[model samples]
Target: MEFEVVVEGAAGALVAERAGAARVELVAALVDGGLTPSLGTVAAVLGALSATRVFPIVRPRGGDFVYDRYEAAAMEHDVRAFAAAGVHGVVVGALTPEGAVDRPLVRRLVAAAGGLPVTFHRAFDVAADPRAALEDLAGLGVARVLTSGQEAAAIDGAPLIADLVRRSAGRVAVMAGGGVRAEDAADLVAATGVEELHFSGMAAVPGPAVHRNPRVRMGGTAVPPEDERRVNDPVRIAAIMAAGRAGAARRARP
Candidate 1:
């Protein structure tokens, strides 16, 4: 099996690459569930990675997958920028107000990708119907879909993920993600039957400054400034990759 690690910046990408990750999903402000990374960050990450495929998230903001016209345009612009930066792929998804895949908008983004592969992000988890959404994305020629089967964690949603994988029938790859731990890698692969897995092997690290602010806050009520920043851990990533390999080996046995 292959592992795709979610990274916050170029530093995290480098760490994940060194840890044997096959792919890295670059993003900004992961505390907000990941917004689009800046063009400079994308370029730096691409420059640092040689073997690992870089797929930057194209989300303009957090909160909801429903995007306005302006937001959609911004996402398209970012997609074009990343493609120009020589990224391997892009993670993108947009939903209608009614929680359906926004196919028209997604088509625009995919076109702006300039022939690079696109992975429909977790917006699939919130789609009104996951099976229908998967078919729609396949029709759009999406290379893969990253989802946790609409549950809080991939293991918890393994049944749905397995069903989706069986239903896809190789039309589109289904990548299980969300709260994927190193210890559970084998079980998740066995249960979901996914050839690829996505996860944030993140651990909290203290900020650079020695002193800390007591009252100031950079994020909203959900994520506070003093919550300690999270970065990708190489040890955890390697462990997950090893476990996933073991699982894949098991599945390949006759």
Candidate 2:
């Protein structure tokens, strides 16, 4: 049973380390649901937190889990690059046209991970059938699967998560993620018996004001070109980690 924080940058890693997290998933542009982090970012986090295992997301972009041929190629390259750079694991996933787990393609990606642990990311939630997908992922030797219990939130999906936990039966790790806050992680663990919890621990940060082109507004009104949203914040990360640790400890005690 361990807690891993998803870190978008060096600042995030620092927070995770200080909070005593077991590991950190290094990614970039969490604004887009996390893209592959730069090599320097990976290197820096690894150097700064030598003991904490770092797993970098392998997606070249953030959007849908289904990737085209070119995107798939990029994913392979990203996995190799991360492995060469000494990352502990690569987090990735892909699906087929029918919304089923793309078993063959995903297996290839897993193989490319080159002995490093591979985690099937939340793309598992989109699988047409979660039970079948879990079996498929286990067969592919995926070290873990990051899922939201195929629901909007882990708590809401706790039943399915518990079912999957029973189904998996230690064949592979089932990590409960998505919409998980420090407050709810313990409940999720208790209800589903999941040992790994994941979340961004995000907070709002100021970005550039997005404004539409006023000079070209001959037929349009003023509108912001760019809109802002909440993103991962270091301050909140520690609190989230504390909550996870406290929760896991309580569960372990009795």
1-30 per-residue lDDT for model 2 (tens digits) = 577788877777877777667778888866
- What is the number of residue pairs that collide in model 1? 0
Taking all chains together, each candidate's TM-score versus the true structure is 0.96, 0.86
For the record, the alpha-carbon RMSD of candidate 1 to the native fold, in angstroms, is 1.3
How many clashing pairs per prediction, in order? Answer: 0, 4
Model 1 weakest 10-residue run by lDDT: 218-227
Query: What digit string (tens of lDDT, one per residue) describes model 1 on residues 72-183?
Result: 9899999998998899999999999998899999999889998899999999999999999999999998999999989999989999999999999999999999989988
| Stretches of candidate 1 exceeding 4 Å from the true structure | 224-227
Identify the runs in model 2 with alpha carbons over 4 angstroms from their true place: 206-235, 249-254
Output the lDDT of residue 143, model 2. 91
